[model samples]
Target chain A: AQSVTQLDSQVPVFEEAPVELRCNYSSSVSVYLFWYVQYPNQGLQLLLKYLSGSTLVKGINGFEAEFNKSQTSFHLRKPSVHISDTAEYFCAVSDFLCGGTASKLTFGTGTRLQVTL
Target chain B: SAVISQKPSRDICQRGTSLTIQCQVDSQVTMMFWYRQQPGQSLTLIATANQGSEATYESGFVIDKFPISRPNLTFSTLTVSNMSPEDSSIYLCSASGPGGYTFGSGTRLTVV
Candidate 1:
């Protein structure tokens, strides 16, 4: 079984400010981690994923995440955020380690990042 | 990754009515899953649909309420039966490929 935890339900920040959205997962085995962003009235768009290589992974829209095995966490970060980056962010985990196939994803309750001027 | 096109983007239905949401994936996918997001809440898995087999539903969902069909690798439908106010939510379909999972735009359903 896999579960994800996102401690903050909402995070408010000013434009150009740095921000972090925390995510933690619990699984019996190693898993694949992902971060997705959903703009207002839109569907989910993949921001980044952690499969095998490095602990730090970068994504689109100037976002990045670090996978910390010891902490069971994959928290998303952005050095400087933009107003356009305001959206609902979700942290997800999958049991499948296969590179090309699909697996059921367990998602955390999303964190809404509100970036203002 | 595959792109999912889901329809009946938004609907308002009467109590006891049913609504079927359809999703067509651009590429063939082995498994497709359905999720529901109630207003002001995170999404919850409803079921997993596999080609040539009955859908595997989650703990709180049943076939009688949410019937799913995977006619082929590229398409599926999820029907919400006997909807009540509680059934009002956003429905989304997803499929994965080498790039990763992609979701449909989502169907926003309102039961009154």
Candidate 2:
């Protein structure tokens, strides 16, 4: 089984400022990590994912995340945030098992990023 | 990547009533899932809709309350049965593809 944790419930940042959203996870087996963004009254959008190979993964909207094995963390970061970046972010994990299992994902509680002007 | 179309986008239902949300994927997907996002809460997996079989539900959820059907690989439906005020939430459906999963717009259910 896999579980995800997003400690910060909300993060407030100014426009064009740098921001980072923390995420941690625990799993007995290897897993895949993902970051999703949800706008107000909308479904989640895929931002980035960490499957294998590189630990530092980049996604759309100038967002990136680094997967750290020792710390068990996959923190999302953006050098410069915009007002439109204000949304709820979620960190999720899915057990990939030995071969591959398009299995279910366990999501974090979510971090609401409030990017203001 | 698979594109999904889910509906009804939003609905207002009375207590004890039921509402069915549908998802249509552009391409066939290997796995399909249903999720619920409660007010001020995160997404919780309701069940995994299996093709031509019963859905595998998660803990704290049952088939009686949330009936699911996936007649094919590209179409699935989830029905919230015996609704109440507590059942008001956003319901989303997802389909897995090459890299990651794609989500529908989600159905905003308001149970009055």
Candidate 3:
């Protein structure tokens, strides 16, 4: 079983300021990490994923996340944030045991990012 | 990634009634999942919509309350039966593809 823990419940930042959302996980086996963003009343959008190879993965909308194997962490970071970036961010993990058939994702409690101008 | 679509973006229903939510993906997907998001909460997996077989429900969910059907690769539906005010939530469907998973816009169900 895999579990994700997002450190912060809310993060408020001024526009153009850098922000980092912390995430940690506990899994006995190797797992895949993902970050998703949800706008108000909207579906989740994939921000980025760490499958293999790259520890630092770049994603759309100028967002990125680094996977730390030893720390069991995958934290999302952006050099600068915009008002449009204000949303609920979720950290998820999927264990590789199910042959990916049971690709059930365990998500952390979301962190609401509020970008103020 | 696949482009997923869900029907009835928002619906208001009376208590004890049932509502069927639809999910369609542009391409054939190997796996599809249904999830529920309560007010101000994280998503919880409802079931796995397996093609040509019964949906594997999660621990707290049941087949009778939330029935799912996956006749083919690109389409699936979940019917919330005998719904109550507690059943009101955002139902989302996600499909797994080459890159990763893609989610539908979600169906907001409000039970009165």
lDDT of 2 by residue, B28-105 (tens): 876899999999899999999878789999999999999999999899999999999999999999987768778999
As a TM-score, model 3 comes out at: 0.96
Poorly placed runs, candidate 3 (over 4 Å) = A97-102
Each predicted model: what fraction of the native A–B Cα contacts (within 8 Å) does it retain? 0.53, 0.58, 0.44
Runs of candidate 1 exceeding 4 Å displacement: A97-101
lDDT head-to-head 2 vs 3, winner: 2
Docking class of 3: medium
Candidate 3 per-residue C-alpha lDDT over A1-117 given as tens digits, one digit per residue, 9 for 90 to 100:
899999899999999999999999999888888999999877898899988897999999999999999999999999999999999999999876233254688889899999999
lDDT of 2: 0.93
| Cα error, candidate 2, residue B77 (Å) | 0.4
Which CAPRI category fits model 2? medium
lDDT of 1 by residue, A6-83 (tens): 999999999999999999999998889999998888878899999889899999988999999999999999999999
Q: Estimate each model's TM-score.
A: 0.97, 0.97, 0.96
